[model samples]
Target: MTTAKTPAAASPDTPQPHPRRWAGLAVLSASLLLVVMDMTVLNVALPQLSADLRPDSVQLLWMVDIYALVVSGLLVTASALADRFGRRLVLLLGFTVFGLASLAVLWANSPAEVIAVRAALGVGGAMIMPSTLSMIRHLFTDPRERATALGIWATMAAFGGALGPIVGGALLEAFSWHAAFLVNVPVMLLAIVAGLFLLPETRNPRPGRWDLPGTVLSIVGMVALVYAIKHFGKDGPTDPQTWVPALVAAVTLSWFARRNLRRPDPMLELRLFRGPAFTAGVVTALAVSIALAATMLLLTQWMQLVQGYGPLETGLRTLPEAVGAAIASPLAPALAHRIGARTVLAGGLALSGLGLLVIWSWPGTLDYWAVAIALGMVGVGLGSLAIASAVIMAGAPPEKSGSAAAIEETSYEIGGALGVAVLGSVAAAFYRTHLTSEELAAEGVTGRAAHVAQESIGGAMDLAHEMGGAGARLAAQAREAFTGSLEWTSVAGGLLMLAAALLVWRLTPKDLDLNEVEH
Candidate 1:
C-alpha cells in the first residue's frame, strides 16, 4: 500500500536534499497562494462588479463561476503537459500568462470580456496549480520531513484563502473591481523572477505518447457536466437545455473512464480510485469545496447587502474562519493519533455541518456573532482535510506523483465549479421564489426595473437607491426575501456536509492510522 505524498522533500542522505529545496518550496507556496487567492477574491469583488457591469443573473453567475470550470477543464492536460515538457518551464510560463491575463483586466469593460479574462487566468492557473504539487512530491522524499513540509503547505493554502477577500476588500475600497485582479500582476511577476532563480527543472522521463483523445474527452466532459449542473439548477431537470448537455457529459465521461481503465499508460490513471484512502481524499475535496464555495459566495453578499457592511468590513468578518483553521491545522495530527484518522476525517465535515446548522438555527436574524461561530467551526473542520493530501499522495507510486497531484487538484477545481453552480443557483431560486414578478409589480416597479429588482439583491439594491419611498419598501422586501433564501441554502449545504461526513466515516477503514501515511 502506498501513502499519498504532499509538498515535501526526499530523504536528505539519499537525494542530498536538493540544496535549494526549502527555497524552492517558498516559491511554490507563493505561487499556490496567488492561485488560491484568485479563486476567492471575486467573492468580495462581485457586488461592485455587478453594479458597474450591470450583468443579468446568468451572466453574473458565469463571471463569478467560469474561472473554476475553466481550471477544471485544463488541469489534467496541464499536468500532463508539464510532465512531458518540463515542470519548471511550465510553471514559469504559467506565471507569465497569469500576470498578463490579470493585466488585461484593465480593458475588461463588458461582462463577456471579464469572463474571458477569468478564463484566460484559469488557463494560467491550471498550469501552476498541479506543477507546484508535483514538484513538492519530488522535493520531499523523507516521511517525517515530508509531514512537516505538508503542514506548511496546508497552512499557506489556508492563509491564502483567508487573505483573499480581505486583500480584495481593501483594494476595492479605494478602487474598482479591477484592482482585485490587478493585484495578481506584481505577485506573478515576482513568482516568475524567483522561480527562475530558485526552482529546479524536473519532469517524468517516461511520459508516454500524448493522449489527445483522452484530453479532449476530459476537458469537454467536465465543461459539459458543469454547464449541465448550472442549467439544471437554474432551469430544472425537465428542460432540454439542462438534460441534453448532461447526457453528452454522462456518455463522454463514462467513455473517458473506460479508456483510462484499459490503457496501461492512461491519461488519468483511474486506478488511483482503487485506493480507499484516495477515494476518501477526493470525496472530501469535492464535498468541502461544494460547502465552502457556496458559503463564501452567499455570505459575502449577505454581509455587504443585508448587514450594511462595506467590503472591508465584510472581509474582516470572515477572518475567524482562518483563525480556526490555523488552530485546527496544527492540532489535527495529534487528534488523529489519539483517536483515529477516520474519526478526524469524518469529524471535520461533521463539525463544518454543525457550523452551517449553527447559523441555520437563527435564520430569522442572521446574527454576526452566530455567523462568526459557524465560520470558526468550519475553519477547524477545514484543517483536518490536510491529512487528505498525505493519504492521497502516499497511496500513489513515486512515478505517478504527477497523476496524483492532477487528480487532487482536479477534485478541488471541479468541486468549486459545482459548488458555485449548484448552490448559488439554489440561493437564486429561493430568492426569486420569495420575490416574484407579481410581488415586484405590486410595488409599482414593473418592466426592466422590476426584472432587475427580482433578479438579484445587488441589482435590486441599485434600483432601490434610485427610486423613492416605494423603492425603499422594495429594498426592505428584497433583503427579507434574500434572508429566507440564504437560510434555506445554508441548511441544504449543512445537510450535504453532514451526509458527506457519514459517507467518509463509512468508506474509510475503521482502523486507519495516520502513522501509515509516511511515504
Candidate 2:
C-alpha cells in the first residue's frame, strides 16, 4: 500500500519507496510499447493510406505530424493533472481514450477524419506518456536500479517504434491500411486490463492549485512554435503565415518562462534547466531524435518506393535497428555506471553520427546490407537516449517527477516534429530542384501529370502507370532524385548529431555519478 503523506511534507532528499515495483515496471513498459508502436506503424502505412484516402500534399503532411503536435502541446497540462489526481488513474483513462480512438479509425474515410482521430489519440498519448515515467521514478528508489529500469523503458520505446514498420507491413500484406490502426485496439485493451490489476495509484498529496494560465500559455506557446517550424520548412521562413506563428511562439514562450520562474509552485518548472546534467540530457534527447526521425522518414520511403519491396519485406528489413537498439539499450546504464555518463553519452552520439555519415556517402544504388549496417549504428547511438531519460528523472526531486517527465517527453515530441519538418523540407527542396520540368516535358509529360510527378516519388510512380514508356523514365528519374535528397539529408543529420555529442561532452560534469545525484 502507498503511504498517504503529502510530497511537500517529505524532505527533498527522501527516496521513493514502493512494493511490487518490477511487476509495475512491466505493466508500464508494456503500455509504452503500444504508444510508441502507434507512431511507427503510421510511417509504413502512409503509402497505402494515401492510395485509399487520396489526400492532397498538405493533408498528407498533416496526417503524419498532427499527432506529435497535439501531444507536445498538451504534455504539460497532462503531467500537472496526473500529479494532482493520480498517475495510474490518468494512465488508465489514457488507455481507454487511445483504444477508442484506434477503433474510430475504422470509420475514417477521409484525411480530415483521420486527422481528427489522430488528434484524439494524441490527447491520450499525452496523458499516458508522462505518467509512465513519473511512476517509474516512484517505483524504483535505488539510483542504479532506476537507471537500469530506465534503460529498459527506453528500450521498449525504441524497439516498439522500430517494430511498428514490421508489424504494419505484415498486416498490410493480409489486410488494408485499416489493420495498422486496428492492431492498436487489442493491444491497448490488453494493456488497460493488465495495468488496472498490476499498476499502483500514486499522486502528490499536497498538490498546488492548478495553474490554469500557465497551462494555457504552455499549450499555445508550444503549439505555435511547432506550427511555425512546420510551416517554415514547408513554405519557407519568409512566408507571412510562418512568421506570424514564429512571433507568437517567441513572445508567449518568453512570457511563460518568466511566469514559471516567478511562481513558488509552477505548473512546469523552468528551474529544472539549471541542472547541468538535466540540460545536457534534454539537449541530447532533442538532437538525437532530430537525426533519427528524419533518417527513418526517408529510409521507409526508400524501402517501399525505390527498392520495390513489399510491406512485409520492408518491415523485416527495418528490424536491424530494433536488434541493435535492444542490444545496446539494456547495457547503457551499466556502461554509464562504470565509465561515467559523459563518455557513454558522447560516444553514443558519435557512433550514431558515424552511421549517418556512412549512409550519406553511399553510392547511387540502394544497398540493403549497407543500410542495415547504418541502422544498427544509429540504434547503438540511440541507446544513450535511455541515459538521457535517467538524467532527467534523477535531477528532479521525487515530488517533481511529473514535471520532469513532461519536460523530457516534450523535448522528444518537439524534436521529432522539428526533424520531420526541417529535414523533410530539405528532401522536398532537393527533389524539386533535381526533378526538372523540362526533363518531364522531353517525354511529352505536361501540365497536371508533370506537376504531380514533381511533388513526390509516390506521385511519380502513380502517374508512371498511365504514361507508357515515358512513365518509366519519370519513375527512374524520381527515384534518383529521391536518393540524392536522402544523401543530403543524411549529411545534415550526421553533422547535427556530432555537434550535439560535443555539446553534451562539455555540459556533463567530469565525475558525475547517477546514484549520488539521485540520493
Candidate 3:
C-alpha cells in the first residue's frame, strides 16, 4: 500500500530560514505596527475631528467604523491579488497608497472628504495585513523560527496598541487632529524604503485563475454580513432594515461555498477547515478578538468617565496590558511545548474570562489596581493567541499561505467589529435600564432635557452643567447608571469568553503540536 508523504519528509530543507530572514522580519514587523497603529490612532482624533468637521451622529459613527468594514470586506480579494501578482509588489503598492492617503488628510475639511480618505486607507490596510503574514511564511521556513518570529510580530502589535493612544495624544497636544493622519506619512516612507531592500518577492507558482465571481460574492457577502450585524446590534434584531443585507449575505455566501466546493481551483480552499488545528486556530483568532475589543472598550470608558483621568493618563494607565502581552507572547509558545497548544489556548481564554468576571463582580467602588490586574490577565490570554496565528499559517501550504493570512485577518477584523457592536449594545441597554430618567423630571428636568440626560452619561453631564444643583444629582445618577452598565456588560463578556474557551478546547486536536506541525 502507498502512503502520503509528510511535509518535512517531502521537503526536508524547506523549513530552513532565509539568510536575511531576521532583517526581513524587522521590516515586516514595522509595517504591521504602522497598520495596527492607524487602526487605534483615530479613536483619539474622533472628538476633535467631529468638532471641526461638524459631522452629525451618523457621519461620526461611519467615520469611526468604515475603515474596519472596508478592510474586512476586501481582505480576501487583496490576498488573492497578492498570490497572483506578487506579495512584495502588492505590499509596496499598499505602502504607496497608505502614505499618499495619509498625506490626503491635509485637505480633509469636511466629513465626506474624510470618509473618502478613510476608504482609501482601508484599501491600503487590506493589502498590507495579509501580505505581511504570507511574507513571514516565505522568510522563516523553519517552524520554530517562524513561531519565534510570530511572537515578535505579536509583540509589535501589542506595542502598537500601547503606542497609538500615547502617540496620538502627544500629537494632538502639539498639533491638530490632522497630526494623527499625517504621522503615518513618515513611518510609511521609512517602511516603504526598508521593505524594498529587505523583503523578498514571493507568489504562488501554480495560482489558479482569479475567480471573479467568487471575489464579488466574498466581498459583497462579507460587507453585507458585517453591516447587518452592526445594524442588528444597534437597532435590535427585529429591525427590518437589517434583514435585507442579512438575507443577501446568507444567500450569496452559501452560493459561493457551493461553487468553491465544485471548482477544481477555488479562491478559498474550504478543505483546510477540515483540519481540527486550523479550525481551532481560526476560532481562537475570532473569539479572542471579540473578548479583547469589548473589554478594552469597557476599560477605556471607565478610566476616562468614571475614574476621571485625562486621555493621556488613561493611555499611560493602559500600558500594563501591553506590558503583560509583551511578556507573555514568547512564553506562550514555550508553554505550549510543555503542556499542549490546546491546554494553553483554552487556559488563556479561561483566565481572561476569570479576569472579566472579577470586573463584573466588583463592588460599586472603582478600583484602578483591580482593573489593571484584570487587563493584565486579558493581555496574557490574548498573548497566547500568537501561537494560534502560527498554527494558521503552518497548516497551509507555502503557496496558499496568503489565503490563510487573509482568513485570519478577516476573522480578527470582523471579530473586533462584532465585539464593539454586540458588547456596546449590551452596555447601552444596561445603561438605559439602570438610569431612572424619570427622576430627572421630579428635579424639574422634563421633555427635551430629561430625554437628553437619559440618552447617555455624556448628555446627562452636559445637562447637569446647565442645571446647577439639579445637574449634580443628574450627573451622580448618570455615573452610577453607567457603572452598573459596565458591571453587567463585563458579566456578559466573561460568559462569552468562557464559552469560547470551551469551544476552542473541544475543537483543538489532542495530538496537535505547533512545533511539529508544518516543519
Ranking by TM-score: 2, 3, 1
Runs with alpha carbons beyond 4 Å of true place in candidate 3: 1-16
Q: Any residue pairs clashing in model 2, and if so which?
A: none
Residue pairs in collision within model 3: 15-142
For model 1, state the Cα shift of residue 141 in Å: 0.6
Off by over 4 Å in 1: 1-16, 511-519
Candidate 3 per-residue lDDT, tens place, 1-519, comes to 011222243346574456677888888899888888787777666656765887866787678678887997899899999999999999998998999999999998899889989989999999998999999988877666677777778777767776677677678778998988998899899989998888888998988888999999999988888888777767788887579888989998898889888888778777778878788888887877776676676666676667777666777787777777777877878888789888988887888788788887766675788787777887777777668877788779888898789888999988888887898788888887767656777677888877767766666776788888757877788888888777777787788889988998998877777667663
* Candidate 2 per-residue lDDT over residues 1-519, each given as its tens digit: 123223333346666455567778888998898899889899899999998999998999899878988998999999999999999999999989999999999899999999999999999999999999999998877776677778889989989888989999999999999889888788888888888888888898778788888888899999999889889888898999799999999998898899889988888887999989889889988998788787798999998999999889999998888988888898888789899999988888888898988887776665887789888898888876668889888789877899999999998888887898899898999999998999989877789888898888998888887777757888889999998888888889999999999999999887878755664
The positional error of residue 93 in candidate 1, measured at the CA in angstroms, is 1.6
Query: Which model, 1 or 3, shows the larger lDDT?
Result: 1
| Sequence-dependent TM-score of model 1 | 0.93
Winner by lDDT: 2
